[model samples]
Target: MVDFNVRLGLTPTDLELREIQTKRPAEFEALSADDSPELRLVEAQFAGKIVSSRLFRGEKTITVKKDKIVAIAKALRDDQETAYNYLSDLTCVDLLKVNKTEEEPRFEVIYNLYSLATFERLRLKAQVTEDDPTIDTVESVWPNANWNEREVFDMFGITFNNHSDLRRILMPDDWVGNPLRKDYPLGGEEVEFTYNVRGR
Candidate 1:
């Protein structure tokens, strides 16, 4: 028999595995506001913008209003203290079945940012309603958001306003329905080809 753990370098040293085995689940509670400098910076700068914030398992997520996403993103990237200059990833989540209130939006767009200077990371979320599934683009702040926003548009049917060259990146131009939505029908469908299968 082969020792895959040693081969793959998965062996833990300094009692790492022992610590994980003895850890308590109760230690995963949300951290206080003072514990997160990023949350404090956002709240202090953009008053009334943050809807909610939580720091759990060393990850900080701040939920903000949909309309203010662009402005907030710009500020965070430019701020000397925060300097969240790296746009690590931008994606969306379907919250139709999980929504607790009628007023809650059906979609939530998440922005993962990292600050190279501070060596810290933060996540920002903005809710989007099915009625108007649109929000301002963060491409102005982070140019790489162009493709990330496009992928979200293609998969989740959420529009990023003023995104340069906003179009389907993964799906065909004429493809109907966003595939990543929870409500999107499963299973394959018959696709009508615009071009001949064999060369004429």
Candidate 2:
């Protein structure tokens, strides 16, 4: 078994430091929105659109209203200065039990983007409540989001509005529940061995 400390090429001291940092988020140095040029560009271009932004450990993440995802995505792709033309990955996170306090909008849809020419990366996020777990699709901005959005829908039940073909890409058409959900029951579905044997 690989040692946890060495697994990440980190020494024991480095692992301890990382653990401390993880536990103490307040100690994280908060950089102003203008500190990041990309963020500044976004703030200027899309005024009043950003909900929150973070620059931690050299990574940037911005949260925006769910309704404006498509517009902002298009801007990121088309904007000459912030040419984030590549959608690296699209996924969702269930924040049901992970949040310390009772945070609204139990799910967050994440979009990872990259600018090939500049080699700059950015992450965009939108929060949707469990009651209305849906967000605007970015398929118009990035055609590749078709399958990624479908997988998120299949695994988390977060619908992507205006998606051309938003169906289950991983699960069966008749699957009952979203398995990736935090509240989804463990090993709830019994294997239909009898049906398989009969068919055989």
Candidate 3:
């Protein structure tokens, strides 16, 4: 038997330390203070809608309320100053096991946006509670969100309101549970084998 275990050699903390050390002083300061230009713009435009923001490894992520995501998405795309015209990806994260305190919501719908002119990227996260795991669809702003949203729905059971065809893209319609959810069971069936010999 071949050993398939492989090590990356460095831990996540090491990677984070390296990122911090490699950044310029000004850039490091900006990240530390949460004062990036894009973050400032988002705060200024969507003050009340934004719940929280964080910077990690030079990447900024803004979290918004589920109900306010559509308006924020529209502004991010249509606003001249922050013309994030591209919706690179849309997905969901199940936070049931990740949030030990259970103070946060059960699901997070993530939107990866990009600007063609500025060549910048931003990640928008909207929290959805287990009781109400639904959010407004962004397919109106970017057509590509249709399939991505479907996949998220199929995997996480996070519904996207106003989606044209909100059906399972990867899993079958008869599928019982969302596979990606943390509480979902790891299911497998036992196999039986029988051997017979006629002549030895």
Top candidate on TM-score is: 2
Clashing pairs in 2: none
Every model's TM-score = 0.78, 0.80, 0.74
Residue 32 in candidate 1, Cα distance off native in Å: 3.1
Clash numbers, per candidate: 0, 0, 0
**Model 1: CA > 4 A from native:** 1-31, 191-200
Candidate 1 lDDT over residue span 1-200, tens digit each: 24434444554663245545654553345546677767777787788987777777788889888888888898888888889999999999998656268887788899999999998999899988899999999988999999999999999988888888999999999988888886654443444486746674
Give the winner by lDDT.
Answer: 1
| Whole-model lDDT values for every prediction | 0.82, 0.81, 0.77
Tens-place lDDT digits, model 3, residues 67-116: 77777888788877678999988888887755246678888899988999
Q: Of models 2 and 3, which has the larger lDDT?
A: 2
The digit string of per-residue lDDT tens for model 2 on 1-200 reads 22433434555564345434555335444447656666776688788878778777787888887877788888888888789999999999998766345656789999999999789898889888899988888898999999999999999999888899988999889998898997764454555775666547
RMSD of 3: 8.9
Reference-based TM-score, model 3 = 0.74
Q: How close to the true structure is residue 10 of candidate 2, measured as C-alpha lDDT?
A: 55
In model 3, where is the ten-residue run with the lowest total lDDT? 1-10
